[model samples]
Target: MAYQSLRLEYLQIPPVSRAYTTACVLTTAAVQLELITPFQLYFNPELIFKHFQIWRLITNFLFFGPVGFNFLFNMIFLYRYCRMLEEGSFRGRTADFVFMFLFGGFLMTLFGLFVSLVFLGQAFTIMLVYVWSRRNPYVRMNFFGLLNFQAPFLPWVLMGFSLLLGNSIIVDLLGIAVGHIYFFLEDVFPNQPGGIRILKTPSILRTIFDTPDDDPNYNPLPEERPGGFAWGEGQRLGG
Candidate 1:
């Protein structure tokens, strides 16, 4: 009975979030079991271009180090914000969400080439949080019950926390940069005086992932709330 309940709960996670989070956990598990090594998973330009190890491109964003506090921390934020974004702003628009993932990943990859970073999964998580916070600007956020801020500052707060931990802030910054570029393109620019929509979800993706019977009048998330989840009511961020 317990196993059945757990399975049902797992099934409730939105599709894109479910798949990505599962991949991250399974990749980490594979490493923990000694089935794979970090050396094989970290992004390598020469190995990818010359040796044709294309799997590295995706695997690099799967493993988030060992299954300790850092790993758990990243997984929590990744799962929560990814699910919120999917079930909120991106609801009934699975194809567009997938496109956002693709767009973010592409930009990160291009940036990764110049930086000496290996694993990008953490940065990818930050990007999701960044985008979600931007869309729900009025949603209040609390950081580990210590700080309170509006949605737009969430990404920077996260970066500050990373700095406090002595970790490099480059990954977080990269995610923020990519997230802002995407946000400006998808949400900001098109609404400007003479700006036009620059990013369009491909028809093929819509055919493959979108729901055909989406309600025309449905609003998954309101402008001021994040899919009905309360963030600053004595709950810890990422809890």
Candidate 2:
């Protein structure tokens, strides 16, 4: 019964988040089973363009590394925040959410061409975290019970922690940069004086992802539920 309930709960996750997290997990499992190698997954522009190994472009962002602490840490953050963004602010806006994914992935891939970074999954996770943090600025967040701050600082705090972990800060920085650009254009600039909305969601997206609303005034209040769910309230350090 317990396992059945868990399976059902897992199925309730938003489609995009569920698919992404599953891919990451399965990718890691495949690596652990020696079915595929890390070399095949890492981003390599030369190989992608010249050798027609185009799978690397998408695969790069799917695998973090072997199954261990870093993989677990990143997967937790990815599942939590990705689910929140999809179910919270992006509720009923699947197409727009997907566009954000495409936008971020494209920018990161372009940036990856210059840098020697391999797996971009961490950066992609950070980008999602950054966007969620900005959207929920008033929400208080506690990290590892050692530090506390408003939501917007979460990505930077994670970057600092990454520095402590001896991991490269470049990927985190890249994610932050891309995330900020998207936020500024999508959310900030359009509301500013003399600013026009440039990042319009396509009509096809609306037709596909949007539901006809009967209550136009309906606004989703920030969830005040307990943590260990999706809202990040009372969330702990590890998964």
Candidate 3:
């Protein structure tokens, strides 16, 4: 329950099945504030200092260093995975479900940043996987697309790329690490042992959207996964 500190049970009783709805809202807000670029946020001390906003982390999540044309498509993929995660955990209280995923993303980013300063390349090892980790928690990931399944271990894959690329590649790795921590610490670790200590949603919301109900928005994702329920559930971002 120590982690329950990140609660947002008020969004929806069960919250919404698709977390992208929230992502969209947050992203939109950042765009409106003209903070969509890395220059405006990561380097701008004046804006952040002037706002005096405590939750500056939220602002950072809104800015990505771009992934070429794959950005929009990948974000959509992230939303899909997040939606499923929210629905599965929240059940009736979708808000908590959404919060869990969103929080995981936020936490991983922070953790990645922290670790990057010390072990730059290692931070990304966690980031790549999270990007396509919707099915990551499963013992065996059913990749969204493809005939068979595989651990879309994007984090590590990206890490390999970073080690080869050098220097500037650190930021991308750090970004993915941030997303990985959110899921690993909050869900995977506690739930690891044999029976009782597994992570379980606290039944927080009132009423909300249920998942796998075949909602129209329910899309088929082309997700990547790691090994086991949380095996190296990680990835490194492309810079």
Candidate 4:
């Protein structure tokens, strides 16, 4: 019999996964272009904007290279959050999350350049994503097979490290502001007639994007989180 997809729940996506993936790829491609030198990449739109490359925006996610702990943390965080989001948002609305992430990162990067704190672009990225993650604090992950931990520690810890490294905090603060405004406008009045139904109620804003109620049938393990990636078992044990 012809069947309709279950509409019992929707999927979600953590904001950082796309941008962090984008940053790593950009760094790798920069090196490939013989632009590996320390000073070459700074304020280099050629790499960030992909030399006016029309396809750069999409390619950025695949352009990453290892940048020490940042890359490792990203891999782990992405697995956990992406799965959680997918499980939470069931009607395949993960695309909306990605849109917010990319646009938010772009806004932060723009502000970073305007204020001359170009170096802390990544810091701003985490801030933009973390604010949303906090709203859904019930989310948790196993800490490297050690302990079950939550509270969105990765983003906040990274921010602290950035501060200790003498990086600019204003950029991150400003990025959060930009994300807040973006979230508001995206929901309350979207273009498509049915778009509002898929809209997220972010916790940061008092009214909209609040912690959306968990679906009664929402089983983070089977039906949602790992179904696409087949992460059913991995997700259950807390990856």
Error of 1 at 52 (Å): 0.4
TM-scores across all candidates?
Answer: 0.90, 0.88, 0.46, 0.47
Instruction: Write down the lDDT of every candidate, Cα atoms only.
Output: 0.86, 0.85, 0.43, 0.47
Kindly list the per-residue Cα lDDT of model 1 for residues 1-239, writing each as its tens digit: 99998986787777899999999999999999999999999999999999999998899999999999899888888888888899888888999999999999999999999999888999999999899888877766766667888888988998998999999999999999999999999999999999999999999999999887865544332234333433322222443
Best model number under TM-score? 1
Task: Report the C-alpha lDDT of model 3 over 1-239, residue by residue, as the tens digit.
Answer: 64463342323312342333455446545665676644444423344458764344444444333543334433444444444444444334554554554555445544544443322212322343454353443323333232233345544444554565563555555556565555565556667675243334454432343343544433332223444332222232331
Best-matching candidate per lDDT: 1
- In model 2, the runs with Cα more than 4 Å from the true position are 211-239
What's every prediction's RMSD, in angstroms? Answer: 4.4, 4.5, 11.2, 10.9
The 10-residue segment of model 3 with minimum total lDDT is 116-125
Tens digit per residue, CA lDDT, model 2, 84-193: 89878888788899889989999999999899899999999999999999998877787776677778999999899999999889999999999998999999998999
RMSD of 3: 11.2
- Output the TM-score of candidate 3: 0.46
Candidate order by lDDT, decreasing, is: 1, 2, 4, 3
Could you tell me which 10 consecutive residues in candidate 4 have the lowest summed lDDT? 228-237
What is the Å distance of residue 98 in model 2 from its true position?
0.2
Clashes per prediction? Answer: 0, 0, 34, 13
Tell me the RMSD of model 2 versus the true structure: 4.5
